[model samples]
Target: MSIEFIYPEFEVIRNESRCIACRVCERQCANEVHSYDPERGIMVADESKCVNCHRCVALCPTRALKIVKSDCALRENANWPQSTINEIYKQASSGGVLLSSMGNPNPLPVYWDKILINASQVTNPSIDPLREPMETKVCLGKKKQEIRRDENGKLVCEMTPQLELSVPIMFSAMSYGSISYNAHASLARAATELGILYNTGEGGLHEDFYVYGANTIVQVASGRFGVHKDYLEAAAAVEIKMGQGAKPGIGGHLPGAKIVGDVSRTRMIPEGTDAISPAPHHDIYSIEDLRQLVYSLKEATEYKKPVIVKVAAVHNIAAIASGIARSGADIISIDGFRGGTGAAPTRIRNNVGIPIELALASVDQRLREEGIRDNVSLVVGGSIRSSADVVKAVALGADACYIGTAALIALGCHLCRTCHSGKCNWGIATQRPDLVKRLNPDIGSKRLINLVRAWQHEIKELMGGMGINSIEALRGNRLMLRGVGLNEKELQILGISHAGE
Candidate 1:
């Protein structure tokens, strides 16, 4: 055996007493982890290939399979963990950067868990969501700072374009090439049904998804892959993706292997050509340059759609957001370090960017202090896990929240973190025809709708508990939130007092 050989991280245990040798596990796994041993009259597994995605276990009729983490260990060393050792070995052998999917899996402080929401006690009575109306609707765009009146005291009602959402949640970007066609369809349909929006990552929109344009937010990244006149005009909003949370300051890369047929045509790239986006837009070096693109997109859309500037949350995010607000952008979307991606350099994903809670608080406070809070709406996304996170975000000054990983989970993604391999067993993050067919858009869309609807109900309940009826009232209302297990710095940055204060 080679000295660099690393043991499989997972072991597949098959109960021989219940094994029927049906070959169902062999047929279901795209990784080819399971196969029939004809001579032994039994099913066997190549544990080395297993990603622990659970496709085989879920499909087994007899429930005869289970996958568990391997118990093997190296010499105990607190400074160097097994995963770290494994990564070093892999990098030494491959001489390449390590890649990962999904959000950072580090045990960093989750501010959401540390924060607590306040409920009405005595004076301001709580409202019953079941009996009373609770407004979860949100409007994302530049808002009017003051009421305008004509000479005759008549109200002037001119307003810029805005995205009106029934719920303060939108599905975050997941590109067409990065994820399967059915996955995009599911997100589009669900966004339409839920009266929300879904971003079209850096990948260009498919020709068939034009019907969902009203509920779509097409993106223009450094690559400018699928962006064109028609593409800009087709969507309700346009997002200029300056950076992503997972790999901030770095551009995107979609392997040529996944860029087949429609993916190639949609991106306007030749087949089998790697789509590598430049780390920076050649024309955009300053906020002034960003303003030019924002206006150009608005001009292309005939001033009919709002423009959003999306950036990764880094140090000095407040200053960055302030600049974007003044750059003719109608909205600013901040993606924190914990945001999920199809694939990202492991080091960047885990090391770069700040938490969304801190970024949102700082940006909102800075904008308010500068008297420009109304210049643009604030949307935050990194790891918005549940309805409670949504409520906490709104109280911390977000106009709305974006969810990517949660939405994928609703679509049946086991999050094996092998999206770059393009062999997703759940038909989510794959381009294979057979795997893509596994996800029925009908079922996927319904599941997404159910998830958001349930969240909406919970949001209303949360609002009612706080004695707040509308999202407008909850926006930037820091008094309704308090910190529990946080230090003075965290509590200060979050703009909320410690609990029991």
Candidate 2:
């Protein structure tokens, strides 16, 4: 029952006369829109699949690319808008919600680019990463305030066990219901191989993923989706997602249509009804309430896995982080404004929260001021675009970095940001069988490992340049970082001097 309809009224036309064939457009495009065909001797494009990401257009060497809305007209229908009719036609032909994944792919300010990464030269002699011993591994959890020993020289009080990683980079939460089992498998395998952890976002972990439990981070988001005693105890750490950067102050809606069979049973909600997560945690009304949950998790897990309270970075985040520090949370994960989402409302994604660099600097400073910095470890994310950002985060006070978009990119996500539509063509974010099978877990996991491994070396190099070998030295080493083009108040808040000082 396939209905036939023409697609993409808009088409990109590359003028060959002005084309230099530099292949910049091919290299830049994530969609594989523009590809070189040496036999034809000109670049070729798949106009049908193009979502107008404009990567090719932006990188064209000779200003040769232009996207044009097709002027070809159909039978005019004044009753319904042209777009409305076209959408219905498109759906009739393809039968999907225009699904996309990764982040809200909009033209928003990327603070990481605005900020800069420093390398050592004359003032700070650079240690060669090739020869020098660089330590980039980090553990996220509460470190014992004071190690106690008995008068008889026997060790006394115990410290919490942490999720130890070979490097500071980790995979963020992607729920089973939202993503496929294969995708989860890929994450699990990669995490196990990389000696880092992968988060099970909200969705309960299947029995199959238990082999990777030592490297798993179980999350408890607002919906309390599939949360139970066994679920809590099965992971190395637990994360309570208070908010996400892409859609701060707003919860998410996993449409009922996608909830089928196991997904329906696993979530414990009826199929064909909207699976909505409320904005606020029903039990968490204050710091006291937060403490209750943290202790409850501790009680359930026998005080083994550390409890993490994740919040979106927003105004007064420093103050809020101060409260979370006192709330018995062993870790505080901050997601900045640019953090990606599966299906956050477009408006919320663009307008909510603050940048990670600013938020990280402020939260670290505030906690240090209160002398509670060691109470909890910090992990921040929201468009941590590259290894440089990861290095910058560590220098700015984060103990580790959580990467969502970058991980998905390793899984072949193009960052179209239309995830809510649920028709992701790449198969990385969608649940449909035909499309989901497109992603090979073997290849996806390898790419993920590749990304994190590259980042690890770069992070180490940055640490080496700062005359530091261990990541611990750079964790709160604000002196290694100097503010450039920042205002007086910002510089004061970040506790960094202006560059060249």
Candidate 3:
């Protein structure tokens, strides 16, 4: 016997007087949520199929539609929430592990919101960013422990390969198969235009994007998809993806259905076959093994490119980062729990990792205490929302910040959390030709460029208010920050004091 289910999550409201029966909603909805009734000559919606992406609402001609959460309840319980019960029912019926996309939706503490920035008041007056030169340019790489000089006494400036950014923001990794070609184009063009970098997330670089190699960071994950000697040589740097924030210890799986055409060729995998990335690199069992791979990449690139080790932020992140610093890696990228992903198991995404703020603070402090902080540059990602976040991340000791969700939003993602379905109507996270064409790379690139440019201006304004003229002066300056509503342990971990103090 089929049991009656709970209420639909969303309720679609369409004004009868304003809808005009234009059928625009019917035509635009990729989920088949809207249908035109021949007998009634009206547009009707199937709320059960709605993901609430807001595409139809935005495109509606007469402001006739709105979607709201259903006021339906199932005898609410605090300990066992409605969502938990729903998940149990879903699992029992389907016998499948629940999958979700985007960042963890759990209401975990976002430290950036708790932390407050300090402004110049008396001793030091704030500078006018418009009139004064505010330097935001940053280089990500190891700093030499001691300077070397030639026989002529002229200091030699031979430093390892470094990534230079006009702004302390970068478009984080989103692979080709996980997203569309147009999305990659947008990121590549924007990175080149803004003089920053974009990461090729474990999905090997497409042949067409080779021209943007100078601004790209090629990733090498456990599956080692799309990696080759030429791919390594073409990139400015190489990143070893040990773990991702969304699924800390889990592997990545790009379903066979999304694998086709260029994706198949680029990843060097068979068409319509699941591209599974093992949880751990078979060859890397210890820190020593990690060091070997790091050196191997450097050697493959003729020691010209710096290597970055990317790991998820977890409870023992400080200790893990310390080992990576000593693993011959020039950079360490830590993804916080709130970082975005194409797909992750529902339980792991919300319950596995720690916040970026705490991890960054602890890792920076540990590296400094070990006198190895200068050995590797720290880059943090997992939901850097605004310029304030970038400033806060730097003050907490990050060299720069990576923005995945923000970049996708710039490219027209509505954060509906349905990315794993591979039917993104916005064109940012789908492989379908028709849906992919909806995103014009030319327009997408411009929007992304505008976002970073606006952020750069705001970063300068924030730095000016702090009486700092360069990003270097603000790096790891915890005195410039204060925490609110946090206990002593949290404040201590973040290396900041209470807000009022």
Candidate 4:
């Protein structure tokens, strides 16, 4: 028999005398921190395996479990906060920036909560999804204004070739190097099976995943890692990631420790070198320069696949999105401040960018006013926690939704947010071979399918309840959405009145 132990940094001291023994801690803990043994007749915790995620500490009955700093102490420091002191120790020992993965776990405003959802009752009767079919399929790309026909009534030009997805949900950008081979395989396989798309991020596509090319969306970022002619043409669409939502106005860096072996070879960059994506495209200081890169990729690919330009939702996101729509980009993906990242500077991750809800609404309104809403498809991401968020995103003018952290959770990620250390216990986001092997692609892919299928059904239900039969009908249907507890400016911008008179 083998036993593994995890010495948690935080320890829970349970005062049994104060414990009501109601098992509230057991019920609240997703990790099963508190277990009640009938023989023992008391709640016991296996502290060695506890993640110190605070699930039980927050819900203990009678406040019996008082979470405290671990008794294990380091060299004392007189002048620093506990967290700062620990950070100094970490840097002194490893000389590396503390890194974390997934979305920003720090407390931030989740606009979805502040906003509200509406349902039909006495006025327009709600339709039941169980009775009839509802469509969640969404097409991503340009839509033409009016049709033109020749003398023979043949069409001159139609809408740009959009990627027809079976659902409005897509797997977000996660590079091969940031994630493992098995993880990539699972996403590719599941994307193919679900009739959705998975992004390759900027690390380029693995040769093994080329078989799933029909379901892939390859990325071309500032670093241009592993990008070649074949990488450009071998996907349904190409995304140029200008910035990410987690750290807007900042670039990305996949540290040297993670750049090893296959990840090294695939990126075509030197091993042990920090893979740095500069904040600004070196040649692009203006919108014209942005267009240069956009058209460059387009001409190189012969306009075969739709080009998507993804930008973080910043304060000026509306203007930026409008420029992208006119830059010959067939699609614009806006990531909100709450979006996840493999690694980001703490300052940037916590205090940068705008909410995705506001960004999506503002961008759509700006594009529509400019008569350019049909110029590109809009895909938004950043803490889209459930199917309800997906429904709201489409109604707010997004063509589709992108999901990242949720997908990882389905594949067994605990949201430990320690991916930057390259020592993830779960296989979802690390280059370490031992840790990477933990995720079995077959099982992971199946789980991903199950998650998406469940959400697909929920999407259909949400649409049916809104008296909408198809996803197309729900797209940009602001009339069906009325903001609650929102200011007048916010209501005006969202194009929906406040809920109730």
- Cα displacement (angstroms), candidate 2, residue 363, comes to 0.7
Give candidate 3 misplaced runs (Cα > 4 Å). none
| CA deviation > 4 Å runs, candidate 2 | 1-109, 122-125, 154-157
Q: Which residue pairs collide, candidate 1?
A: none
Error at 205, model 2, angstroms:
1.5
Is candidate 2 or 4 superior in lDDT?
Answer: 4
Local accuracy of candidate 4 as per-residue lDDT tens digits, 287-330: 78888888898898887789999999999899999999889899
User: What TM-score, over all chains together, does every model reach?
Assistant: 0.99, 0.82, 0.99, 0.84
**Cα lDDT for residue 58, candidate 2:** 60
Candidate 1 per-residue lDDT, tens place, 7-59, comes to 99999999998889999999889999999999999999999999989999989
lDDT of each: 0.95, 0.80, 0.94, 0.84
TM-score of candidate 4 on Cα atoms, chains taken together: 0.84
In candidate 2, position 16 carries an lDDT of 86
In the range 111-221, model 2's lDDT, one tens digit per residue, is 455456566778868787789788888888877878789999998866676778899888987888777777888899999999999999877788788788889999888
Q: Report the poorest 10 consecutive residues by lDDT, candidate 4.
A: 1-10
Backbone clash pairs for candidate 3 read: none
98 Cα displacement, candidate 1 (Å): 0.6
